[model samples]
Target: MKQQLVFATNNPHKVAEIQQQLGDRYAFLSLQDIGCTAEIPETGRTLEENARLKARYVVDHHGRDCFSEDTGLEVYALEGAPGVDTAHYAGPQRNAKENNDKLLSALGDRKDRLACFRTVICLVQNGQEYFFEGKCDGRIATYPTGDGGFGYDPVFIPDEGNGRSFSQMSTEEKIAISHRSRAMVQLEAHLKKQSDVARPTA
Candidate 1:
């Protein structure tokens, strides 16, 4: 049987992405699969901190090897107002559409629309913790576009695109060179090199 890993996340899309990214190396599991109902507090000041907090929580409480990741949309025009709070930027109660709309409104007259998506992943096993970061630079569209993807994908135009948004791209295309995917590649490589995945010692 493959090693079963608990992914500290409630989002099905994220879990699915990770499952595919891992490429059959291990059996994927999520917080809901293990009966974790309490919300993981995102008290960290940065993406790495938040990711480690969630990953460590799974291992510490669930007593299993686990990993977690946090992603954010950083807009240069907004001075990165929502870097660490992408999901709840418009408040935790609203959905993805609300969050995206607010972001576009905030950048009303800005022509540059320069922005990027960043993902910080924390992998932990047996008290060992490692952090990996991935970033994709792009520009924000004046209005949302396409129907594919989730979250801010509708308005995120990748660096390669002249103006097309992420929602218009296929899943394979998005995964091929997305911020989270790049970070996962780095993380998977690191985990392979180091047998011991544990929290850093002081």
Candidate 2:
């Protein structure tokens, strides 16, 4: 039997990406699936804190194994202006286009375009907590290009990419090297270790 776990997020894109990356090792549950409709607050000052807050909220409220992740695009030139506020960088509306526009305007012809995407995942199971982090070095584009991805994907180009934005890449290609993907890889390994320890020796 597959172990059941709740992914503490309502974002379809994120849920889909994670589910695709995790495969069949676990049976994933969504907030809607478990009747959790309350808006979870993200009052943390950092990605790790926010991820932990969300995961803890689900585990405490639902009493179930749950995981949450927080991702940010930190631009070196901008002095990491959007590190923890990536979603609401522009305003409280959380509009992706506005956020991207604001980021580009903030850069405003500066030559230093170094940036990185970072993701932190927090998992809470049986009152035990774990964290995994991943980061992808990249540069911010002058303008948004592709329309395939959400958030800063259109304006962010990974260091290992072929000069194309993440939005330009196929989902399979993006998942192969995304910050979230890297974090999920670590999570998979940890879960496997826990499973092995719990298995009965013959």
Give lDDT tens digits, candidate 1, residues 1-202. Answer: 6657787888988877777778788787889899888898999989999999999888888788788899999999789868998989899884899999899999997897999999999999667787889999998999999998899999899997556788998777788778999998987787666635454557
The estimated TM-scores of all candidates read 0.91, 0.97
lDDT of 1: 0.86
Number of the top-ranking candidate, with lDDT as the measure: 2
Off by over 4 Å in 2: none
TM-score (C-alpha) between model 2 and the true structure: 0.97
Clashes of each: 7, 0
**Residue-wise lDDT of candidate 2 within 1-202, one digit each (tens)?**
8888789988889888878888877878888889999989999999999999999988888888899999999999888979999999999899999999999999999999999999999999778999999999999999999879899999999988899999999888899989999999999999999999999999
Error of 2 at 47 (Å): 0.7
